[model samples]
Structures are given as structure tokens and as C-alpha cells.
Target: MASKERKTPLIRVKNLYKVFGPNAGKVLQQVKEGKSKDDILAETGHTVGLSDINMDIYPGEIFVVMGLSGSGKSTLIRHFNRLIDPTAGVIEVEGSDVMSFDDKALQQFRRHKMSMVFQRFGLMPHRSVLDNIGYGLQIQGVAKQEREKLARYWLETVGLDGYDKHFPANLSGGQQQRVGLARALCTDADILLMDEAFSALDPLIRSEMQDQLIELQEKLHKTIVFITHDLDEALRLGDRIAILRDGVLVQQGEPVDILLHPADDYVEAFVKDVNRARALTVETVMKPQVCRISAETIGEALAEMRKSKDDYGYYINEDGYQGVITQETLEGVEQSEYDKAIDPSLLDSVPAVHTDALLEAVIPETLDSEHPLPVINADGDVEGRLSRSTLAEVLSDQAGSEEDDEKVKKLKTSKSLAA
Candidate 1:
């Protein structure tokens, strides 16, 4: 993981406020004094678009801004590039004041420092895929050959390699969005502002685009500001999430932090709908090792593990974790070899998870692993273990199901246990 302490803010907003009306300046004090949005609207005919929003966007992190309609999520992203000026507050990009930028400076900043991918797949209808992807570079006066080269590279990066000449009119929604992503990427901008970038596609395609974005972010590490109303999308993509409601900044934190501890009733209501097992870290339910086998020889460990009837067993050397041993491997060792020095190859490898990983990420690996999943920490040392019962109980509990016993009995086929 990147060390956050060493990173500086790429963008900073302090006491940001955006209100819409001729009397915005006059009504600002009322809103600041804790007047309700409706009362302010009734008295001054003004609508608050954002309220004292403050956050520091770190370098190379995906910062998600999410909210329902009229939450000012869209309005907030527009302030990043000064597309919508704030009613009152600071908007700084790269330590420079964005609100202070003149027309020319703002234009230059928009052209070179930032790029946006819209939910509507804003590709040029008449332009070919290659031309559309290179459109930003073209505007920057890049030569056609060089710009096309950059475009083609990002085209392949986004998995739209052979569809270079196809127009947006001919491509599917997903393909068009891919082109839009590539267009933003080709410019090599420092920050990407994506407003509901994948909300227009079908479920499967939307999921595919989300995965594609994750893979791209892993390789490129560009600082991204993603706007979405979907909690799932925000949890999936955001390194840190900021939720807005009625133009109020309700909460901001890491995904797991938000999921584990919501800031208020509004935030709690949002989390109640998420799949707890899918969003929670492995460490949430991981427990101490259930069965440990310590022996002077490999054969002794194997014999002890057989009594447990589990397919996998933990091997301890001097009462410390060595690795998980398999029942299948133990069956082949001859009695005479019991006294020999332990071989590293004798330890069986099974499915493992990091303590910080979401439980959903390890479920697939566990399907073929009848043994418990060992949870390791950042130092690659065994910290705890996750058993089938715990997983089933957590899942059933999250569902608020009364049939936990039935779920446990059926977990074998439902992928709670390893093979």
C-alpha cells in the first residue's frame, strides 16, 4: 500500500459553499447559521448546492463523491475545475487557487491538468474511435501522428484495440464508454473527474466497466474523482468516499471504515442495504486458530491432525505457525520417515487471505479448499483464521435470516466450505 503520510493533497477545498439564486450572498449567513434548506428557499428563493464542504484529495487515490438526486454530488465535481464557481469558499488544485484563475489559465488547466468522462459516454458522433480518443490531444495542438500513437496505446489499454476506426454511432454503450475512458487517459492528465461514468450500461456491462476501471487504476495510479449514486459502485472503486445529502457533506472516510461505523442515521440507512459479507474485511470475523498440532516430527503432526477430521491442519514448530498441512499428503508418508527432520515441501499450501481483504474476495478460493482460510497481515504472518461456521453465521446474520441452522447445513454447496 502507498504510504499516505508521505503524500500531499493534489486538491483541497475549504469551507466550500455553492448556492443558486440572485440572493445567494445575502442568504449565505442564514444557511451558515443553521437555517434549514427549505426555510432558506422559502424566505430567499435560494437553493444550497453545497455546504461548507471540505476535503483533501491525496495523490493517486480514487476519491468518490456520491449522493442521490439533488444531493449536489454533480454540483460538487463541477467545482473541482471551476466549471461551477462556489458561492463562498476555497477551491485549490495543486496548491493553486482555482477560483482565482482567469479565463486563459482556467482553459489551460482544464485542457492539460484535468479530464472528465461523463455518464453519457460523451464521444464525438462524427469522429472515428481513434479520433475521439485523441480529441483532447488534438485540441492541445499535438501532431496527428503522435496523438494517434497515444490514442492507440490507450485504445488497447482499455481493450478496444481493433475497433479504432469504428464511430461512436456503431459501438455499444460499453464500447463508447471505453472510448471515453481512453480519451481521458490519452491526455495523461493528472486528475480524472468521472461523473456517473458507468451508470448508463446494463448490469453486466456496468460491472465489467467497473472491473476494467479497477484494473486500469492499478496500472496507471492516476488520481480519480468518481461521481456515483450507487453505494456498491462507491464501495467497489473508492479509496475514500465522501457522501453528500441536500448539499451537506455528511460523511467521508475509507470504504471499510464507513461500512463498519457510519457517522449518523442517514449514513447508517445507506449501509444497511449493502452486502456485509461482500464489503467487510476478513479480519472482522477471523478468529484464533481452532486446532494446532505441535510435534517433534512430521508424522506426529499428521497423526494428531487425523483426529480432527479436517482436510487441513496447522503445523507448529516450537508452538509457532509453520504452515497448513494437508490430510492427502499425510497419507503418503511411511511410518519409518516419521523421525526425519521436517521438510519445507511437506507443508501443504491452501487458500489464504490477507486480514484487510474483503471476505467476498476469498470465497471463490475457499470453494475448493475444505481447510480453514488463514488470515495473514501486512507482514505476511498468520494473524487469525476464518472457518466455515463463522462465514455462514456472518452471512446469515447479515441477511437477518432466522434459518441460520439451515444455512449452515447447506453451506457445503453454497461455497462456505472448501472441497
Candidate 2:
């Protein structure tokens, strides 16, 4: 894992606000004075687009802003590239204060350093795909030949190699969005601002586009500010997610961390239905030094695992850890030839997860499957096994912890009432 100190933040937003009203200044004054939420809402009738927001976006990180329609996710994203100027507070991009830049400076900043992709595929109907992708480079006075070369490279990069001559109007919705992505990427800007960029596509195409974007980001390592209302998309794409509610930043962290330890009721509700186990892996939840096993007889394996009193057993291969066969699996199976005929490819099951996955993710896979799964490290060595009982223990602990917290809260409330 990379050390946090080694990663420099590429963008920073501090105490940002964007209230829209004639008396926005006075409204902000009231907000800063620590008025109650209802009082502030009643006084100016000013919608707080963003309130006292503070965050750091690391270089090469796909930082996602997620929320509902009026959550200020869009407004917050706009502030990064200066699409919408903040009413008060500071926004720094690449160590420069964006709010202080003059019109010419800001224009130059956007043209050279930043690019945006909108939910609607913004493309010219009459212009060819090449023209649209090359538009930014052309505006910056690059030679037509040079820009066209760059555009062609991006078109190919975005999987639209032969569609350069086609007009946007002729393209499908997904294809048009690809053109938009290519256009944003063609500028070779250091920062990419995507505002619900894949929302318009059908679910299948949207997933395809997400995969494409992940592949591209892995290769390019561009710093991206992605905005979306879809929690699943945010969780899937974001290295770190910032959840906004009524313009206030509710929570921010890696997806697993956020899901496992939501900071508020709102965030908990947002991720309540998410299949966390799939998102997490065995590596995150496995206990250390658990019993090890070989891909031999089930009776022998069950006896050894039971001796260790562990829920799961790790199967070792000539190379390293191969798979896991648990007691649950052994108990559930009836003596059959099919069990003996288990494919040798079973040894090649999906690689085990590191100890970093959230319980929400690790639990489901263990429960859903008939066999215990191996938890592997980055080097493909089997670290341990994660099984159904382990998952149950995690869920039970979570529930117990919540109950304890509630008791603590109630105790505090009662004490305060007596005082």
C-alpha cells in the first residue's frame, strides 16, 4: 500500500459555499454565525448549495461526489474547474487558487489544465467525430495536423477507431458518450471533470463504459472528479467518495470504509441495501494462522479443520494457497461421485482478497457459496480461509456494537435530563 504522505493532494476545497440569491452574502453571514438548520432555512429562504465543505483530492484519484438531486454534488464539482465560482472560501487546483484567477487566467487554466464530460453527450451535429475531439487542441492553436493526430489517438483509445468520420448524430447514445469522453481526454488535461457522464446510457452500456473508464484511468492515471447520484456507480468508481446532503458533506472515504462505518444515518440509509460482501474479500476478514489443508479427502480435511476449531481450512498447492474447503461444505455434501469429480480447475478459483475488504462485502460471498473461499495476498499465497461462520460472527459483532452504542447514547441522555 502507498503511504498517505507520499501522495500529494491535487485539488483542495475549504469552507466552500455557493448560495444563489440576491442576499446570499447576508445568508452566508447567518450560516457562519452557527444558526440552527431550520433558522438558516427560514431566514433567507436561501438554498445552501454547499456549506463549509472541506476535502482533499489526491493526484490520480477518481474522487466521486454522490448525492440526490438537490444534494449539491453538481454544484460542488463545478467549483473544482471553476464552472461555478464559490460565493466564499477557497478552491485550489494543482497548488493554485482557482477563485483568484482572472477571466483570462481562468480560461487558460480550463483550456490547458482541465476538461469536462457532461451527462448529455455534448457534440456538434454537423462536425465529424475527429473535429469534436480535436476542438480543444485546435482552440489552443495546435496545428491542424498535430491536433488531428492527437484526436485520432484518443478516438482509438476510447474504442472508436474507425468512427472518426461519422457525425455525432449518427452515433448511438453510448457511442456519442464515448466521443464525449474522447473529446475530454483529447485535450490531455491533467484533471477530468465528469458530471454523471454515464447516466444517460442504458444499464448494460453504462457498466461497459464504467469498465472502459476504469481501464483508461489505470493507464492514464488522470485526476478525476466524478459526480453521480448512483451510489453503486460511486462505490464502484471512486477511490474516495464524498457524500453530500442538502449541500453539506456527510461523509468521505474509500467505498469499503464508508460502507462499513457510515458516519451518519443518512449515509447508512444510502448504503443499506448494497451487497457489501461482493465488494469485500476474504483478506479483509480472515483470522491469522488458521488451520491449513490439502486438496485430499473431505473426511480427512474435516477432521483436521475440526481439530483446529476453525470455521474454514486453507488448501495449499505446489505453488502456494490454492482454495478453501470448509466444514459447512463437508457437512452439506452427501457421498457422491460428483464430489470426487470436482474439476481440477477448482484449484484456480478467483484469487483470495486481502484483509482490506469490508465485512459487508466479505460476508455475502461466504454465505452464498457452498464452499469456503481462500483469502490470498497480492503474491497469490493463501493467507487464510473465510467461511460462513466467520461472516455470521462479523455481522453479529456489528449488531452488538450498534446496541452498545445505543445504550451509551441513552445513558448520556438520561444523565443530562437528571442534571
Candidate that would win on lDDT: 1
What C-alpha lDDT values do all the predictions have?
0.84, 0.77
TM-score of each: 0.80, 0.77
Give stretches of model 2 more than 4 Å off.
1-6, 36-41, 283-318, 322-373, 382-385, 393-419
Candidate 2 is scored at a TM of: 0.77
**In candidate 1, residue 321 scores what lDDT?**
67
**Location of the lowest summed lDDT over 10 successive residues in candidate 2:** 410-419
- The whole-model C-alpha lDDT of candidate 2 against the native structure comes to 0.77
**Root-mean-square deviation per candidate:** 5.7, 9.7
lDDT of 2 at 252: 95
Which one is best on TM-score?
1
Candidate 1 lDDT over 187-209, as tens digits, reads 99999999999999999999999
